[model samples]
Target: MTKPTFDLQSHSLHSDGVLAPAEVVANAAAAGVQLLALSDHDTVDGVGEAIAAGARHGVAIVPSTEISAVDGSYEDLHVLGYGIDHRDPALAERLRAARADRELRAERMAQKLNELGFAVDDAPLAARRAAGKPIGRPHLAQAVLIHPDNAERLEREGHDDVSSFIPAYLIPGTPGYLARTHPTVFEAIDWIHEAGGLAIWAHPFWDIDADAEVLGAIDRFAAAGLDGVEVFYPTHDAAQTKLLADRCAALGLLTTGSSDYHGPEHRLFRTFLAHELHGYAPDLSKLEQAAARAAEAAA
Candidate 1:
């Protein structure tokens, strides 16, 4: 059988991307992506639309979610879930709770920015969220850029994307920062597994020093039934990818890759378009193997 070629990670308007879930599916079809996943942040609301779009585009749409997991010390540990049951009551309740928490955080962040003399409207943020598109830091960053006093400063500072703009002034401990509560890694992994999905550690090297910390995290995740690790992320170089791949191989963990594409709106544009950088490509064989293993485990 011929191996599948595809991008495993992508976002739609369901989270923060510009395109709708259908549009994302269409774009991936155009990009020659035979297997696609709508790994929307925190919510699985777009999976149904993605499935409909995939049927139309002849692409396999994998049901996926990206959970924000934090350890006891409050470090960010992203866990990717695949083959999950979007309608599973337990999973849905958790996702809904997460969405609510995200809304609360965005509101708090907007209030903090307003108090800091930055122009932002929590109303529209809430309105957009009510319309099913979750509000995120990107909206807040854009609001900051449009502020009269900050506009010139933002442009002068060359903080174009959301990450840079937020990092400069809105991340935790920053001027306009407001910390949001995140789900624990154990909770998220358990939820994913219970929802008939596979849990994967995502982007271990970016912003997260996956040395001793990562090894410790890996141990915990393995005990919790983590099926894979994202070894070939756009954030990783060849050496890093190899190192992760070797680790996964030795540990009997499935390894996978993806562009983590969030369209043009995302601030992380530099790495999001990674496939074009080094002529890289995502291999769906890895994802398939992981999915198979997860299905077997669930069975």
Candidate 2:
């Protein structure tokens, strides 16, 4: 049997992504991904445009979103919802609330940086978001780098992405840190279900340790109605990948392989896309079936 090829995770400018939804679909077609998902952050605002473009490009676009999530044990985990009804009112309301909070947080972070003498202003950030992009730490970092003084300080580094600046300033407990929140994993899973979607736990190894403690945590996630786990992320080492795979199989959970393609616009784009060099592809038949099932269930 031929191996399936798909890239189930990507982003668009509707969130923190650089590419428009249609442009992302076109690029993914060029990269040879026949089936793709534009899982923008917290919004499905781009999915309609992407679905139209996917039809033109002959690539199937999965309408999806990556929901920020929190758990008692995990502060910054994420949940990937596939086959979502992007127009669902409840989902839209939740995302609106989150975006509103993020706006306030970005404003506070900018004020914090201004007080700390970075000379950063909220104008550029607000303007960038005026076009309907997510107001995120990256947008703020880009705003900071726009300052000639800070730009000169970061000049020798030659970095166009915000990877370096985020940890330097915006991480939790850092100077520009603002406490953001997400629904608990349980609540996020319920939201996905409500949207007639399949909720997959995104990148479990992010903060999970390899121990009985982590294994116990996995069990808790399974109990929370997570349909699958992202076992084939680029960051998962060979052993870690196998560990997640084993856990998924043992628990009878669906398995997914995704590039988590953030596109070339990201400062960290070089990092995640590098996984493609290591040969990352997903089983499209499985993904297609899952999408069909979710669509029917949603209908």
Regions of candidate 1 where Cα sits further than 4 Å from its true position: 1-4, 264-299
Q: Write down the TM-score of every candidate.
A: 0.85, 0.86
Measured with C-alpha atoms, the lDDT of residue 38 in candidate 2 is 84
By TM-score, the best candidate is 2
Q: Per-residue lDDT of 1-299 in model 2, one digit per residue for the tens?
A: 13335767888778777788888888888877777788987788888788778777877767789887677745567788887788799998887776777778788888998887776756777676787667888778888887777666567656445888887788766787876666778887898889888888887776666656556767888898888887777677777777777787789877675677777655444223333213333334656865554344434
lDDT for residue 151 in candidate 1, whole number 0-100:
74
lDDT of 1 by residue, 1-299 (tens): 22225567888877867788888888788777777778988888888788777777877777899887677765456788988877688898888888788778777888887787677745656667679767778778877765566777667889755777877777656877666557888888898999988888888887566576766667678877888887767668776766666667767887666778787555564133253223323335655654444334433
Model 1: colliding residue pairs: none
- What C-alpha lDDT values do all the predictions have? 0.73, 0.74
